[model samples]
Target: MSTTEVLHHHHKHCDELFADAEAAGLHGDWAASAASFARFRDELLAHFATEEQVLFPAFEAATGMTGGPTQMMRFEHAQMRELIEQMEAALDQRGREAFAGAAETLLMLMQQHNMKEENILYPMCNRTLADTVDVAAGLRQRLEEACPVSA
Candidate 1:
């Protein structure tokens, strides 16, 4: 599969997990909420690491552009991580309003982030990485390792 295809699949997987966590918490299922949020947090962090540590660096090397879209993506990722931390804390406290509010904010941020990645970065990665064999494969392998196929 292409880089875009694989990363897009991961996006869907993460999104499903996000929906599960948000729904569980919003519906007052405290136990399910906590468990699902934990899973979602773990998967989200793994996804972020896959992009920041592997995909972004590889794309930078391939294109020789260090401070382009990838930089912006890294910034957004840090923002998302902070929100996730807050959400996790809220879940711990069983603060329904807090968790839901954070989830709403995260949902918006994720929508924008995923759009930029799927429409721009993923295509660029597909094109740029196509110049060399195994780079895309390596990225896919790294992602799969970071987040298992539990989806």
Candidate 2:
């Protein structure tokens, strides 16, 4: 599959995770909410690692452009991670208001981050990367290994 296609699949998974988190929160199931958020956080962190380690470097080498799309993505990843940490902390404390606020922040950040990656970075990688197949395959493998069971 193409890199774009792979990212699209991951995006769908992200959507499902978000929906599940929302539902868990609405039902006042703090345990489920915490689990769902943790899963979402871990999956996203792994996803970002795959992009940074495997795909971004390949694209950078191919395009001979440093600190372009990859830098922006890295910054976004950090923001997302911070939000996840806040959410996780709130969950740990069983603070519904705090969790809700964190989740709201996460939802906005995640949606925008996914849009940036899907609309900009993935397409740029698809166009520039010479070893697209290898990069996509490696990402698929990493994703599969990182998330064996869907949450």
Candidate 3:
């Protein structure tokens, strides 16, 4: 599969986990909600690491464009990480409103982030680094290592 395919699959996986977490929380199942959210957060961080440590650096080296989309993505990753922390705190306190608000914001941000990466950044990486790097394989391997085949 291409970089787009691999990363896109990961995105959908994270999205499903996010939905599961939200549903559990809405139903007042704090334990299930926390478990699902933890999985979602871990998978998301691993995805970011795969992009920042592996794919983005490779793309930057190949194209010599360090301050482009990858930089923007890194910034967004930081924002999402902060939101994840907030969600964790909310979960710990059993703050339903806080968790819902943070989750809503995260859902929006993730939608935009995934859209940009899927449509623009991944395609650009595919075009720019296709000839030189097996980025998709590296991404697949790292993701599999970071997050095994669990749900």
User: RMSD to native for every prediction?
Assistant: 2.7, 2.3, 2.1
Which parts of model 2 are misplaced by more than 4 Å?
A: 130-133, 144-151
Whose TM-score is greatest here?
3
* TM-scores, one per candidate: 0.87, 0.86, 0.90
Is 2 or 3 the stronger prediction by lDDT? Answer: 3
lDDT of each: 0.83, 0.77, 0.86
For candidate 3, give the lDDT: 0.86
Error of 3 at 138 (Å): 3.7
Q: Which is superior by TM-score, 2 or 3?
A: 3
Pick out the ten consecutive residues of candidate 3 with the lowest summed lDDT. 131-140
Clashes of each: 0, 0, 0
When summed lDDT is taken over every stretch of 10 residues in candidate 2, the lowest stretch is 130-139
List of clashing residue pairs for candidate 3: none
Candidate 1 residue 78 Cα shift, in angstroms, is: 0.3
